[model samples]
Target: MASWKFPGFLIFFTLFSCSFSYTFTITNNCAYTIWPGTLAGSASPRLSTTGFRLDSGQSVKLTTVPGWSGRIWGRTGCKFDTMGIGNCETGDCGGKLECDGNGAAAPTSLFEITLGAGNGQDFYDVSMVDGYNLPILALPKGVYGGACNATGCMTDINLGCPTELQVLGGNGYQVGGVVGCRSACEAFKLDKYCCSGEFANPNTCQPSYYSTIFKKACPRAYSYAFDDGTSTFTCKASEYAIVFCPNSNGNQKPNPAPASPPPPMRRPHPKGHVVPSSSNIVLLPFPVPMLLLVVSLSFSFIVERPWPVI
Candidate 1:
């Protein structure tokens, strides 16, 4: 007699099949300048592809990673290093409020604006990955009111950000007081940042276009801004209350990702079994060949059995 077992031959043997597919969209929340030069990350820009870059009024449809995350955008001018980042420079300051960070050229000042949230009660700094902190916003044709008046206060003034004060602090290593406003503004809120209604009202002011925000930072001290060690702003903060302009206002609740369910539990097995499936099975190419002899003999005996045979 011979014995054999074929996957628990339940009341009967049956066939089955199944298939599935998954699709997704992605967005990168953090990344470096699209390109870097002799300054820092000049070796490779691969890790820099994480975020998206847009000019004054440009937009893009993100499709890499999905879900909302904090993001930064800018339109760098001359620092347009073909393979490097152009730091603060005079030639192109991305319209003044931003930095051009070019190696050879001088730093140039461009546009500046401030945006706030709430009644502009209390303002906070926008923290950056490297401890570099700031608030952000986008301004159009930025403006800068010159030297603080005799009272160390510049009032109701705007002169499209000054190229004179435009300084790139990132590469220099160290600078003091509130760093001059970097060409870019930290993300911020409209209510948090504000200019005196007395300063020019948005509606009344002559703007190339409207900036999401436009207000001065530390409007008390001589109002002039100074650069910090990290290419950040402290205002002539030490000199006087620095009143730098800004654009970003990170005032809203940053969006969050929905929680994902834990993956299905799988049991441990001595040896993983190959699940049978109707779709994957080739109709005749099974272990049937090995069972051929046994099946034939069983059939012969059943056919010749006395009870039903003549």
Candidate 2:
């Protein structure tokens, strides 16, 4: 008679898939305070807060579900009360600190994103369609695919804004003293610049004189209503950093990652077995190969019993 214990089974299994939450770290490098306003698209979840103040050199980290979509912009020169009511010189949303799904006012630099969009990709862009109030940059992290690229208006467009399109701030000022730049549509209100009526279609509406000025200043941003060829950027990234008034030193040095990373994604195992933190290996107990061997051996042993040696 021979006795044998079960052999240890070695199974190669694919790592369990986990759900990931995307992160957005908004940083302000401006010399003044900026009230960041956010608005979620239809079917998207609102962020932790709709609006908040970010002082110079300060930053805020926000986490959103993978499929969330939204837009963000800075509201300059805002005066808010204890009740969260306020007015902003630009990008005001209902005179409140929190936008609560309200869109920012026109002539505001816009950063928009659709996370985990079609085919697990993110579509993002900085648009001067409304206008330009501040410089912006969208930096992607852990990017995959060739589509990953940085997009934003790093230049201070207000400095070179045309006289007619310049939005002056503070006391009376001369050329090169503007704080914001108005889009052609905002400045002229023409059907062509506004992309309305006869010029509503892509073929009909084209970039205008004012739009050309903006395009030359901020080549990466949307200068007109249908400026999409180079304005929009796409990528698959784990996180993004949206910076306002990024330094123009051209160094583009790497900065430390945000202190808070999104929570680890998890998936429930069928057997309710918890995964060990130390290992990335996933074990499947009683795999098909081992189960079949056990069944075959049991049948052979039963057949060879010889009817109790009768």
Candidate 3:
């Protein structure tokens, strides 16, 4: 009888382990509300909601089954009608309140992830390959594995945004100012900036001047197209917290660089700022409340975990 029971127990455990869901908590730490957008991968399941509002200090959690992979971005200064149709300053998905499966427009920071990815590990990264709107952080909770946690951009890049890459707008407020920053690819569509054409390969596409500036501001983030070594991280957490404007002041005010140099300006653009002689360049400006969506993870074991939730 004991031998028969052991077989049944083993079968149950295997089934449960094979079908576990991971919870993701998206928190808004900025001074204003944000609309978080989600784009499911081609093979991944559709999310419960593709986009939704996340007010300041609020959080929301969503769950995904194993093998789920995709990206998440934030949209600020969004305005929607009663029908839930509208647009945003940055990370707008076809100007729709609900993004569905479409990717956000360029010049928006990105958080990409692949669960149960290669070598039985989950790969995640905070990328500025598109550009930057808000400071973001992706942290693992109670994860037991290698160094796979606490990676994101904490510095407000818009404060020091190059004049050419500045996105000036009301930024969901009454006053107009610099709301976000644009990537080198968006600012100048050259092959080197976009890492396209002959420069697609990692060897040929070395970091350029603009990428170097971004790297100096946020070392943990992907500053350029081929920033794989320090940018990508691996982990095995049952849950993750994706925080927008993480660890910001309580006021949640949007920090827009002054249009004109302030009389008492304290910070200035870095040395060798790129200035486009052509004035037609377009600068584009660029989510969620969940307390906690907990998932039971019986696989937790002792491992050399290095970082805490950031």
Please tell me which predicted candidate would have the highest lDDT against the true structure: 3
> Using Cα atoms with residue i matched to residue i, what is each candidate's TM-score against the true structure?
0.20, 0.72, 0.79
The C-alpha RMSD of each candidate to the native structure, in angstroms, is 30.8, 20.3, 12.1
lDDT tens digits, residues 1-29, model 1? 12334553431343211221011111111
Worst 10 residues of 2 by lDDT: 301-310
Root mean square deviation (Cα) for candidate 2? 20.3
Candidate topping TM-score:
3
Model 3 weakest lDDT span, ten residues long: 261-270
Tell me the tens digit of each residue's lDDT in model 2 across 1-310. 1232222121112121233456777877666778998887765667778899887667777776556766889888788999999787778899999898788886788888767643556667788788877878777776777435667776766666666776776622222456566777767767877888888766888777666666666666777666667666667897787777774222232231111100010111012112111111111221122232223223211111000110
- The models' CA-based lDDT, in order, is 0.19, 0.63, 0.67
Q: Which stretches of candidate 1 lie over 4 Å from their true place?
A: 1-48, 51-53, 63-75, 81-310
Clashing pairs in 3: 30-252, 31-252, 36-287, 59-289, 59-290, 60-289, 60-290, 89-285, 90-285, 90-286
lDDT of 3 by residue, 140-186 (tens): 77586654446778777777787888788675442336667887777
**Each model's total of backbone clashes:** 77, 0, 10
